[model samples]
Target: MLSVQPVSEAGFAAMAEEWRMCLEASDANPLFMSWPWLYSWWETWSQVLGMELVLLGVFDQRGELVGIGPFCRRVLVTPGGVRVARLYMIGNAWRLAPTVRTEYCAIIARRGSEQAVTAALVPALEQLKWDEMISTDVPVDQLESLKVGRFYDQRGYRMIHRTEDVGIRINTTGRFDDWLAGLGKNTRLKAYNRRSYLKKQGELDFLDHEEGRDGDFFGRLNAFHMNRWGKPAFDREALRFHRLLLQRLHLCEGEPAMSLILYNEHCVSVLYDVVVRGCRYNLQAGYEEDFDPKVSLGYLHLGHAIEAAFSDGATSAYDLLAGNGKNQFYKSHFHGEAVHFSTFQVVRSPLLKALYRIQAASPLFMARGLSRRVGL
Candidate 1:
């Protein structure tokens, strides 16, 4: 049996090395669970949200730290004005000014000790006071082991398991050239042709985020994304959060993956990625639409970025992340393998469980009412 201890926010900051070790020993999303990403997120948003923070530290019989649950509680008010005390994985706070998508969120544990950690987790979490707990955007394999959907079933918590085939990714073999060569002949040709077409216009350069161009790259990334979408990508606070995250990752792990494609000394595209455990998660990308109507800037930029990922030893996969709830399925064109994210919701009390069900369907209720009031 493992023992679980509740860690305060200040003490949790000091567990970077321990957290990294457990992450490597386990199969969690290293990028999302990394100290740099979550800490920076807490540093940025917790101040605004004033979340009740607690980090659960799982220890083996030997008293070694084998797991960490970065958890928090926040009270959310519904349209009906009921205040619900909600439990959340620290990184999944949504619709905030600095709302960064945290994919593959999970409980971090040592590989061999997953069951022990989960066993210890139930009692620890039950001691806390929360009506319901939610942790989403997690991959299925991890969820299978964590069993978060049913983690607290013994405590009379109702369990609901939800899933979505939302992730897209391309796996890489051992070598960069081999991976490029394995692509369909048409894809390979187009990837090359896009770059060649741009080269014809002027000097083409592929620059990685580094000391000389860190600020420049981020500025262009925000500008290009905002211009393309007609709204700011990160807003002011999110920009600051990302800037700090990328810089900190660069310093600690040397993973400055925000890449740029330049055409004739002009910025044409930027791809934001976070590389961890040999997989590169392509978070966001923005390109100059005016470069050429005929040229697929994203396709062109991705080829360069994937090559860098391969060269940098990030050969696990190039994850395009997910396209959930979006009308456009441009990522499908990449023809990468599908990825699924699972969500677990556990409501401890019957009364709160009723609220959970209602909130889950609130959107449909809202739309129907709106349509009736406005006569569609």
Candidate 2:
């Protein structure tokens, strides 16, 4: 028999070793979903943010842990009353290649018992008395390749939301020359001229920093980032969180990782990133107002960053994250694929609907409007 148990403090403590083992056994990369920050975020959200944490344990007949499902509980209030709902927190997770992480592999069961385990776990989760349940960071074939959405459909949950597809770009197995050869003549010429102009001016250089060893770099990085991004659409807390992320990289005391500040004598433009497992992440970039808009300094910065990644022997170069119309159109210029993702919602009652509305409408709790309202 398989049983589902709520994740308790003692439970996570006991299962910590098992979790690590399963992750390695399953061949999951640490950067994707096994970062220490995942645990940190879970703890912070559950403790500081008051979100309820539930870790469903799927055990085999032998009573050992087979699978773990981590979710957060959110309350939805409506005219009728308040109802308990489980939130996937997908958008809020802020991860690259989220679903590709192996930890999300659903129902880790012994060979013959896979279907049986899922069959039992479905009703088990559905019966938890919550008005609705959401599973984010889910695999494409969530229910043993049966697609859990179908299972949810059999029970009564309907899919309500979806987002545009996202994508990741790679350029490792070949040389930069090869990549250039692969592009159209016009694109190749444009990229070559752009890079050549920047290099010839001798203003283009990359400032390097390590996690703990580069305190000065971080200081300048903070000032550069703040002076560039501070007054934009982001809120104070959100911006603080972004800086804390950089600080973690600068302060984590690990391998000799690198954060690059691509700049010229005239202006700073982009931040190129390399993380655990030879992954290169590109930031949106900031440039001095005078030198930024006319020359497309940010795009040039990316061209330089990609060149640097190739020189540094990185396996892949990701374009930071996703973008909207103009931004998305710009990304298409790189000739990469975009991934489409959707959100599934099962509104148990009016209360749940109302809660979702508030979350959807006022991400950051309407801090954007609040800031403008107070003229801050």
Candidate 3:
């Protein structure tokens, strides 16, 4: 038999080791799902957003921790002025949606215990006062499984599953040169021309910073990203969250995983990455827009990062994480496999179900509304 219990922030902190053990025991765990990342996110963003942490723990009869559902509770006021109590992943907040923007989220469980853990999670979640439970970036099959769907049906909850975004990933097992050779002739020509043009400017250097070594990189990354986006990549609190994340990763002896391109001692581009298990997640990046219009420094930096990944034996996949409308062109150039992510929204209230139905019927309008609500 298994039992579910709600864990407070303090309790969650105390169970760090057990949480890590559960994460390691699970298969297909990503860097975003790691203990250090979520915990640091909670510590940094929860208070600022006034979110109530609802971390759930599942234990076996022997009192051994079996699974963890890192979640939080917040209130969402829809465009129709409906106030709905919602439960979301820890890194998510109502105002920011995905406050920390971690991908591949799910209940962390032992390799063979996913079904049981997910089954138990449904009833536990139903008992909460939240009108809706929103889980984003979960595996497709996991959301489609009978265990989850059936459990939601038994609890009188309407389950709405939709593909949120397509993630881009590249298998880095092959040689970097071979991978480059597979690109279109135009791509190859552009890459060569860009590199040749940049080489004439000055000495070029590629640097990798590990944990405990990323001093001003984060600030520089933020500035560069702001320059590109015309706004901060993450707000002040989110920035602090990333700093704490680096510290926590350092303490755990995990890889900080950042890459930068320096031209004549000046940083031209930076790639913020995270390496976990065997996969490397390209979380964020930015480049100097004014460097040289003719030379695509951003493309050059990405090429170098891919080469570095191959050289370092990070032989697993290189994930571009979630794709957005603005980045599709750049992501398309990589020729990576597109893996789709799904979100499961379980709503117990009939009114909320109707709202979801209406939202689904007109996704474009809802997207624009959401953009306005969140100031996106």
Candidate 2 to truth, TM: 0.68
Q: In terms of TM-score, how similar is model 1 to the real structure?
A: 0.87
How many pairs of residues collide in each model?
0, 5, 0
For candidate 3, the TM-score is: 0.87
Model 3, runs deviating above 4 Å: 76-81, 94-98, 145-149, 154-156, 189-193, 209-215, 250-253, 325-327, 357-376
Off by over 4 Å in 2: 1-3, 10-17, 27-32, 59-65, 78-84, 89-120, 135-147, 184-192, 211-258, 262-267, 272-274, 292-294, 308-320, 325-328, 348-376
lDDT tens digits, residue span 39-136, model 3: 88888877667689889899999988888878898876766577778888876563454476766777788888887887777678767888877777
Query: Per-residue lDDT for 116-205 in model 1, tens only?
Result: 787778778878888778777878777755555466556576776655657888776457677667677667765655677666768888
lDDT of 2 by residue, 219-324 (tens): 4445555765674422343344344444444222212234443545433543535454465655335545355332565455565556666676645554444444
The 10-residue segment of model 2 with minimum total lDDT is 94-103
Model 3: lDDT of residue 25: 84
Ranking by TM-score: 3, 1, 2
**Sort by lDDT, top down from the best:** 1, 3, 2
At residue 206, what lDDT does model 3 achieve? 81
